[model samples]
Target: MEAGPRVLIVEDDARLAAMLRELLQSEGYEVSLAPDGQRGLHLGLTESFDVAVLDRGLPVIDGLDLLTKLRERGVLVPVLVLSALGNAADRVEGLDRGAEDYLAKPFDIDELLARLRVLRRRPASTVPVIRFAGGTLDAANRVVTRDDGGRLALSERETALLERLARRPNQVFSREDLLENVFADADDPGIVDTYVHHLRRKLGRELIETVRGIGYRMGAAP
Candidate 1:
């Protein structure tokens, strides 16, 4: 017989995780459980799954952070976020970070299963590798390859920020713009400045240019 669709469950609550694993397995899903966000991240980055069910309050890495990292590296597995914080803002934030669906704690088991079915049926998305004068930003792999053949690995946020700038090379993005689009969860807009510094240090100062009193833009390749 063919194997069932693969499912990953990342929840810190051991009993809950085990219950989910058992329930999903009975439903014909091949389930893998991670008791912490760190382990979840490893499994998510290295494994292939039809869908993922992630708890928002995971240890080591928050669910949103894990979701962001998954998307940055081009993991297209549909994710359903499970959180006790089920307010409108929380749901919106989860969706914004790349979750295909959100289910609050105390959720109906039937609803959760229904949502997973929908996510499993959805097609995976593809992100194109961005080319700039200095190098290529492989958003899928989270790597920057210089024209001279040197490659630099980027963290999750770095890849997202660089991909945003590279996608629109001619347009200037204000710090607020980057904050809203790239760092939506960040309270301080200065985080943009910090990541910009990081990228410049690794890729070269000329790779990105700061517009006076405005924001920043993709510069001519170094």
Candidate 2:
């Protein structure tokens, strides 16, 4: 991969996912993992990934179904199917279903890396910074502000976290979810709650809506 491929791995096996994460990270690839196909598909659609490692068998949504949807929606990112089905027919079937490549279980590390390098050869992936609710977020700058010309400082972590939430208004993300997905570490569960509290105080009371007992969600500025 030229600039390093940002890969998304969709696997239900937690241990396998961890091993993949470690291995991919060691290879200098930016990695994101989803425990099920639903989250994986959602991330793939909303976020830009250079390559997606999709398990043929998934719980929430089948891997084939996700590849189909992505292809139907015109998302042409390379997908390398991962499965335990080693038969030649199975591999052929998966590739025919829109997979760029199919790798069976117990594959060698060198081969997996080789396949990822091949996936990255297709193209570079980038995400556009979204604007809504009368404010512009400098995604590259990791900053946000009101359109009224008022300036409020936000730390890098807070700004990045806020940007993720602000991307999809009315999307409720639990504290644990934010901790795991939004932040680099789930070190502080209370940190998300604290960030929400601080963000509300800064952006305005109604900028984010709290769904009692569940999590926090973003909304239009009042």
Candidate 3:
């Protein structure tokens, strides 16, 4: 059987951590939990995980500091910050520090699950290549090859945006869809259009077609 996606849960609350572990495992994910930022940071650095759900309050290292450390160490794994510190500034801080998404405490399990799915999709794939429009997108290396054999690099968000659209070929993705899958909740949906424009310039306008009143799709205009 294929191995399930690996997940790391960094939470101080024993009961809630257990609950999250149980729920995620039931959904066929491999779940590991840490009760404090120290252990969580250790596991997060030492192991591989598709996603990390981090709680802000912890001993030995707070969530924000742990997250900051992770990024400073160049760990690109998607992180979802979970905390009772629910406020605009808190959310902004979490995002500014490289958390992929943020969920306030007392959040619904269903919402958490949905957010996890989105997080998994946001990262560029480790897979070899996804082809479209006579060019190729290498999610693993964050490179895009033009039909003319020119190559260009991409930022994290650019890679995520391209991967989301290119993986589906001609399927159109709305701004909200891109926002949910490729950006934090605190991000503006307009940022989606901005990245789309960026990808078009790098990959060629024909490689990504704007569906006019809709959103964007992966295909050359015919």
**Which of the numbered candidates is closest to the native, going by highest lDDT?**
1
In model 2, which regions exceed 4 Å deviation?
1-3, 123-222
Compose the digit string of candidate 1's lDDT tens values, residues 9-97: 99999999999998999999999999887788778877899999999999988989989867755678999999999999999999998
As a TM-score, model 3 comes out at: 0.57
Report the C-alpha lDDT of model 3 over 14-108, residue by residue, as the tens digit: 99999999999999999999998878877865688999999998888889988876664345789999999989999999999988899998899
Evaluate residue 141 in candidate 1 and report its C-alpha lDDT on the 0 to 100 scale.
82
lDDT of 1 at 130: 91
After TM-score superposition, the amount by which residue 3's alpha carbon in candidate 2 deviates from its true location, in angstroms, is: 7.0
Q: Compared with the true structure, what per-residue lDDT tens digits does model 2 show for residues 3-102?
A: 6668999999999999999999999889999998778867876788888899988997788887876654345689999999879999999999999899
The parts of candidate 1 lying over 4 Å away from their true place are 134-222
Clashing pairs in 1: none
What is the full ranking by lDDT, best candidate first? 1, 3, 2
Instruction: Assess each prediction's global lDDT (C-alpha) against the native.
Output: 0.89, 0.78, 0.81
Residue 66 in model 2: lDDT: 78
User: Of the candidates numbered 2 and 3, which has the greater TM-score value?
Assistant: 3
What are the per-model numbers of colliding residue pairs?
Answer: 0, 0, 0
Best candidate according to TM-score: 1
